[model samples]
Target: MAYGIETRCIHGEDGITREHAYGSMGTPIYQTATFAHPGVGQSTGFDYTRESNPTRSELERIVSSLEKAYDTVACASGMAALSILLELFENGSHFVCSEDLYGGSVRIFSTIGANRGLTFSYVNTADAELVEKAIKKETKALYIETPSNPTMQVTDLRAMKALAEKYGLLLIVDNTFLSPYFQNPIDLGADLVVHSGTKYLGGHNDALAGFLCSASKDLADKIRYIYKTTGGCLSPFESFLLIRGIKTLSVRMERQQENALKIANWLKEQEEIKGVYYVGLPEHPGYEINKSQARGFGGMISFHTDTAETAKRILERVKVISYAESLGGVESLITYPMLQTHGDVPAEIRERLGITDNFLRMSVGIENGDDLIEDLAQALKGE
Candidate 1:
């Protein structure tokens, strides 16, 4: 049988044992911003904090081992990691991306990136034919998000990988939601995998960090160059905290997954719920592909209520679930796409994508299942 998630949580990357250390259970935080050289014109170890540090190296090794990648580089934020990845391609290169990516990513691509000679086309990547037709000779990368935001549409990674190989295109996947604990994109043939460690990997939403991992040495080198030169690397102190958070990732994720499934089922049966979107639900369109790639359905679910008015009232009344945008925290959060996460998305595209006023997204937490269900029920009650 596979190793249980709890075991992985506790000992996933604790390489050094008590015999090697001073019997301290926790990894020490190296908070210094600079390191000294042994002699003039000679570097003994880490020379500067920006290039590398002991704490950050430990975190990188742990994340790479967990993700089953050859290399991993941590950054100040998820956006910084993405920006570094994009530097690999030259200006005027075309990119094919999914229509429903994270709102911040979409904003960067559409607004800030447009002036850099980068052009893009957003298509429903679920349809292999559509993706095939969108590729141009200038296309350099195909960026995608599985279990896409708001709509929860899952993309076929294996199929996309095949297409990328055939077309000489780079495949980049955002594995933030499911995390390396639940899924490893490198195993599925992706060229590069990105994560907002601020989410599940950090587990408590206490750190702002990002990571990019790859199985290829060349790709890893390219990413490392951007990471060091662009100067957006994560701090040593934050890396230490992230390593601490990751020790409990598997257990926390297991609880969150259980909670999400329970809430999804309960919401599906409610009369006020117009539609529920979760890969675990048998009726979901992405079920088969998601099941093949992921060990389990992740802890994110979105649903549409009877109307926008009802959604507004429920959001205003929910007691346990906070109305927040970021996810993967111990406490649950609810967000409205059109007004929150996807607020920057154009009105026309939002309507076409069914990110209507009635839609609500729930980032389920490791809370008592019954209590969470009751909160939703009462929030939906007509007063």
Candidate 2:
């Protein structure tokens, strides 16, 4: 039967039911450490837990199907998946990436490149020309994030795809914020897509997980090799939990997006707020490009107030929204990018990108939009 994402999510990869069997509708977690082999020179799907697991495989298959990719690899964390992908490049090979990305990603790249003599140049990928200009002869990959971190700056995936094709570079997109339901970069020509499943896909702020999806079998195999050898695979239990979380993604995202729109609109009207950045609003710099690609604007929003003092006060006083770093959960979270998500970013770069001390980011939740608005109104009053 043809089904929507919400339906597939609940039933996806959970497996067929045995007739007359009394069982839970949810996918059971297979917590065993290893599986037995059929015989010598024969494999029974899973031989070692480190290499593979039935639970993880089911989650991987479901995610791959959701992303419309040939295959996917689930990892212990998002950074692990990123590490496996970066291993595809030889030492000294260069990568071009978005200047404003998740803080952890930036730190990982900097540390790895410093040790291995690998190179990366960060640029404003929102500007197509700048991205094209940043490509070098040794450039092997183009890494990007849309509705990027604190800035909510949108990148043109189709434009990036064209540049990658012209330069024979692999395009990798971080589709964490929008997830597959809101934006699937593979559909727009990305060779691969990555996610910090700990955020949205897991939904409840529970299990930590990550995934990488690829359309090319050869590319998939390369990633799989690194994944298996590095032993960064997710545990079967976590995989099953993540699968359960993903079943509610569509519903959660819908409510979150709606709440975000309301919050963004309210923030824009505040006198203390300098600017609001969200793709849903037409006045945003990235709105046009974002509209061209995504089905709807996502749940993340960031705004700059007049000063750090006001921002701090607002964060300190916010009632409904928790002061937290992560985004894309059922609970609303507010973070000061300068101190939290993008703290590791160079001050000079952060200033240039407008991720100043005055900036505050919000990941709206499924709660009543009116309640969220009231909470923010009170917080702004205290500020």
Candidate 3:
């Protein structure tokens, strides 16, 4: 029988079995740096950990299956995955990118990639016309983050695909916000899908990991070559943690989204709140498009308060929700994108994008919805 995504999450591309490793039920961590060869002419496939490790390979295979990709590369961090993917483009290549993305991504493109002869144009990718206008003859790729970081702006993937095809540009999507359980960019014609497995994929915020998935074998192979050479591969222990974390993705996401929707709705009713940026909200501009493309609206929500003072008070007062920088964990996290996630973004650009001092991003967890709301309520009310 063809398995559902939830089942696939548990079983992975290849189902778990004892036969694969001397009757071991779980995937074992091949912690060694090098696998011993059977003999001079024979091998055990894994010659070196950098080239490949059994534990990491299993995690990659699982992500590949989840994303419906021909192959996947596990990296040490999300930036590492993106760095490997960027290697596909040569020097002097330009890219059209989403204006509102993880601050780290903007930093890489503006600083690191710029030093390497790469250039990028940032636009509101949700507006296809703007993206089209930004494209130049040197543009080789479209890098976008749907339900973009603090704003929750959703881009039309099919529209982007059409543009990419017309321009013969690679379409790279940052699927970290939704995770594979909620959205598969590959199914929507993304040339590549990048993820910060450190967030939702790890689900616990304990392990840092990243992944790159691609349907094209050629693209995958190129990325794999860069990944190996760069030596940013995830360690065997981290791979094991990620594999374990992915098994509960379906359940965790379901509960997290459930709580998020409740919190988002509650936030909308609050007198102090100015706006709630969550795709699940009917009033959100991206509601319909996000509904059509994703299985869930995701647990990320960003809202604005009446003033920066009020926002800071809430951030400091929240007792149940931790004030942290990362998201997609089981524990609720509230981030100030202005000073945290989007700090690297230029001040003018951030103001234009509405990532202001009053803005706050929340990664709702599996906590009881009522309790989470109560926490926010007390925080907002300064109780």
Candidate 4:
């Protein structure tokens, strides 16, 4: 019988597999560089750390189960996983991608992908017609990031999937924002799902890891071969941390989402706040579409302050929230997109996306709701 997400978060493949060697309560870290073989003709499942490790394999299995993927490959970082995923296509291949994406992703596609003779066209994938118009004869895939980075633009996954099917293109989704507990794009017809495990799946600020979960076995086999060949695998220790973090994913997301909704509503009522971009809010442009596609609106929020000075003041004055770049930790983090996450992005595109000096992105944590609001209130006072 299929288990619920909360149960999966804690138990994983516990009774289904003899994964733990000693049947330990926690997944043991196989902290060795190599494993021994019984004989020349036979072997253990693992050979070298670069190829595989029992600890990492167990984490991959757990993620695969959560995602309902044919297979999942864990990598050193989100960028590494994205780099490997890009390798699947040949030279001169083209892709239609979400316009409002993470700055790092835009950097990669414009530089490394461009250098490799790959081409990409960025469009508002939330509008299926625009995405369809961007497709070319050379297009091999439709790449999307829903509730897109910092700005919170939600895309229609099923619509994108239909476009991909109609055009014979692969549908790849970055599910990092919602994680597996709240959203599974594979179930929505995405060919592959990507995650920055360092964020939600890791659930803490401690470990760094990435994952690429494939819906098709053929796609899984291809990426697995590239993964081992490229050797950007996750460390056994980090894998152990991710496994521990994932155990608390359901609870963490629940509290975070609750906090985010309250904060977004409060932001909307503020005189100095110009706008709030959070899917959880019913007034958000993509709220209904987001509701149709995802189980939750997630904890990420981006808002525009009345002035650049007000934005700066909050960054300096906030006592409860930390001024940081990374998100999805137990601690709430507020970031300046233009100065931090989107600094590398071109000025024109940044401006078009409303990532200005007055814009602030926030990642709500499992903290006291009233305390967080009070902290914000104090920070925004007299602004």
Model 4, residue 381: what's the lDDT? 92
Estimate every model's Cα lDDT from 0 to 1: 0.86, 0.88, 0.92, 0.92
Tens digits of per-residue lDDT for model 3, 1-383: 67788987888755854336687768798888988899998988888999899999989988998999999999999999878877788899999999998999999888889988999999999999999999999999999899899899999999999999999999999999999899999999998999999999999999999999988989988887898899999999999999999999999999999999999999999999999999998899999999899988989999999999999999999988999999999999999999998899999999999999999999999988999999999999997
Between candidates 2 and 3, which one is better according to lDDT? 3
lDDT of 2 by residue, 1-383 (tens): 65676666666633432211367676667798877778899898888888888778878888987888999999999998888887888888888999989999999899975567789899999999999899988898899999898798899999999999999999999999899888889999999999999999998887889998998999999988888899999998899889889889889989999989988999888999999988999898888888888888889999999989889988999888899988888989999989888888999999999989898899888889999999888888893
- Measured on C-alpha atoms, candidate 3 has an lDDT of 0.92
Q: List runs of model 3 lying over 4 Å from the truth.
A: none
Residue 233 in candidate 2, Cα distance off native in Å: 0.9
Which pairs of residues collide in model 1? none
lDDT of 4 at 246: 92
Error of 4 at 39 (Å): 0.4
TM-score of each candidate? 0.96, 0.96, 0.98, 0.98
